[model samples]
Target chain A: MEMTMCGIVGLFLKKEDLRPRLGDLLTDMLITMTDRGPDSAGIAIYGDEAPGLKMTIQSETPDETFAGLGDALTVAVGAPVPLRVADTHAVLILPEGTEAAARAFMTEKGIRVMGTGHAMEIFKEVGLPKDVAARFGVRGMGGSHGIGHTRMATESAVTTLGAHPFSTGDDQCLVHNGSLSNHNHLRRSLTQKGFPPSTENDTEVAACYISSRLAEGASLGEALEGTLDDLDGFFTFVVGTKTGFGVVRDPIACKPAVMAETDDYVAFGSEYRAFANLPGIEDARVWEPEPATVYFWER
Target chain B: MRTIDMATTPLRDLNSTLQAAAASGEGQWEIVNPKGSHAVAVGLDGPIAVTIKGSTGYYCAGMNKAAKIHVTGSVGPGVAENMMSGHVIIEGDASQYAGATGHGGLLVIKGNASSRCGISMKGIDIVVHGNIGHMSAFMAQSGNLVVLGDAGDALGDSLYEARLFVRGSVKSLGADCVEKEMRPEHVEILRDLLDRSGAEAKPEEFKRYGSARQLYNFHVDNAGAY
Candidate 1:
């Protein structure tokens, strides 16, 4: 009855050189929190973007779905669309300004887009954190910042799409550690507003809500602040954008959240152990994020 | 004193090692480099002492009895949860639900404790040196919760026979929780608790809060209150 529903981690590298170690460090943090959530795990990495739009997609049957998909998309779009496969997920790179066409093509092909952004690629699966990370080669990747989640599946099923790091907007994703009490009501409203959530996970509702706020030109901090008033739940959300990392907790602050900042980076975890092995953590300024407060860091 | 390095030893191995040592009558242990591991030194029943050198994750000393545990750094959620007896001390801040559902024992947080501290406590004595977050001691059945600093919203909601003391302001009190007069005996009890917990605050500077006994039993008059 007292089970913690999930674990979330985020890291923003202030020093550009540390970008290459983003996935490695995030994997360590994510795996360290295996005790908090054991059902499934996911990660969203914000690495360097290619010359055009990039969308990460996942399929249960990767072999049959991904084979020669890039060549077919290239012929359909009349431009080069390079595809790279990793386990059940693949990243498709499209020509500049061809996101809509590529998306339409993928939709016609019955592919599920996990996330779409110039710099972000999401990989998630239903398994332990370590296995999921290994299967996706997350540790070998590099990025400027990233967020990860291990879920215990309180509200929905434990499918690959039901995992955390739900994305509803370009270069935007969110990982949540608490359940939302008013998700059903909020989801209906969001769907009416043209930001329909693709999954039943409450975290997806939160992601769409923030994306809608950002679409209205609110800053990342302001959007996160809006959650304190608009959302009714006990949640600790860690969000990743193209250029920033942000965190916020509900008013009650029942879910655990700890943040550590050093000269080189800012790291967040549901517990201190997630970032204990990070370099310079012993000297990092560590503290708990206050209730209903928004903390964001940008390069 | 025995030293257990958690970096080399797995969490289960470390817990089993402590259990074996406690069974062998070892009176003291020094756990080095905990690195925020959960459930450290849990379910121990003996007059033993455990000093964790670094921060710990959730439920560090859950269901403990007769063991005096001290952590030099902050603790994750549910530290000393369901504790039956003995004392647990955290030199740094504590996460939510510290000492939740505790039946007995003393829990001391030298720094701030987050929300739901001592929630549903049955008979535990909790002393917090700094502030505590919202909804602390909710539906508490018995025992004492003394806060040297401020208390957040709904300090004691649906309380039952629990003695709550706060030196600073209370955001709000939940149903059945009311401010009570601090008699001489109350002051003495608080003084003893503060002294035992090594808190510097004076008992005379505190205000007592407890249940108002309005909704203790089923009654037609309490329908609106419920």
Candidate 2:
């Protein structure tokens, strides 16, 4: 028994009908890869919202008690402040120019926040699938694409906030398997450039690093492909964007990832058994995506 | 003989389908795309022969009664554990603990095998063509391990009554276990075993090995190390 890595399941639907009815599709897929994750599970459903930003707070605090972490976000452009506060997280709608101030505030409070565009929303917690969903208010939630995480906890603490799909700014959420051997070096680089990390987990550093690259005009696929040359370790990752989904594998090919594609949807997991029960897949046309390759699906 | 393609079929549905075919008095079964399955030919009570086309997860033919199982790809842990009768042939590699605690059966691997090949065997015949991993026959009470290739360290650590034969180098022999002369009787026995496994190698290409008899009843010298 080697060290267990994270289980990441991604779903991309061609139609809106497949998006809303994704609970069963995702549940069946995740259960097949249960061996990869036995500690916690979560989902981030990207829905149709104004082109804006979404932030997820991963720290020790009562931020989730704030009702409607969903409704508080807005597509404004000026100042940034929390519209509501939840149990251990909060929902804030920041104006465009206030991105600097908002990040500064969260950093000062020792609260880790990653923001993606409004196309993606992330909800995660510790426990099984049903428990995580019930705790995170996933029902009736609509999104075009979603990414999920089930944790086995090889290194990081098993905290609710630590469950993935983590964000970098808004609409950009990431889930990862395998450890980053060069995290300290990467973290030093980011913190020197005013991006002080909140958590000791290496995944946070990876999120920020990719976010930084994309902000510098590097496409999602390019940034992920760039990671293979720069990062040193075994890892397989999937990131959800508003327009599409991105996937990558480390150079070593130590971790496993299986992907299944059809006109209706494209799904991937750490094991072949995970995608065996997709609803519309009448034939088993699954393939193990080669290591060091990045896949981009925009629909 | 009957052939079934299990490419996209659910495992439960395939199991029931095979059972139905057997109930109808089928003598031979061939399965393809058997990706990572456990207990494939379990509890069969007839003169049946089955060949699995691909790799399996665990316990491929556990507690087999009277059926022969042949696997085309590698097998995970416990290939024929606790098998009662019949044969299991592997065309490719095998993982750890193959033929573990088996009472009676014949298991043959055409390729390499991992650790603990014949652990706690009451009675069985396990033949390997390629190299074996560490702890090949641990705590084996009674069985026969014929290895055409090299064996890893600790071939037999604790032995009650088990016979082992190796053609290549022994990395490290376990406590109270040493090499012995291969008599003409043993050579003839190995020749017959090789022919049964469909191996084309000559009988003289293999050598015989077993316990050094110092461990038959443990003494102070053998007791401290093991």
Give one digit per residue, the lDDT tens place, for model 1 in A72-167: 888888898888999999998888878888889879989899999999999999999999999999999898999999888754577888887899
lDDT of each: 0.90, 0.71
Cα lDDT tens digits for candidate 1, B160-219: 888999999998998889999999999999999999999998988999999988867678
Query: Cα RMSDs of all predictions?
Result: 3.3, 9.1
Taking the tens digit of each residue's C-alpha lDDT, what string does model 2 give over B1-226? 6777777777667667666654565478888766555566665655578888866666787777667889877676678888787898988766667888888879998877766778787788899988887777888888788898889778888766788888889988877667777888888878888888877777677766677666577587766687
lDDT of 1: 0.90
Assess every candidate by TM-score: 0.90, 0.58
Measured by TM-score, how close is model 2 to the native structure?
A: 0.58
lDDT of 2 by residue, A1-299 (tens): 11356678888887776777676667666655566787888777776674345555554555443333333322222343445343344545555566665566556656656454665556676777666655555655566778887888876678766677777655777888878789889889888876656677777777877777777888888878888887777778898767868889764454656666777888877654466567654343444454577988876
Model 1 chain A poorest ten-residue lDDT run: A1-10
Query: Which one is best on TM-score?
Result: 1
Predicted structure with the largest lDDT when compared to the true one: 1
Each model's total of backbone clashes: 0, 24
DockQ of predicted candidate 1: 0.67
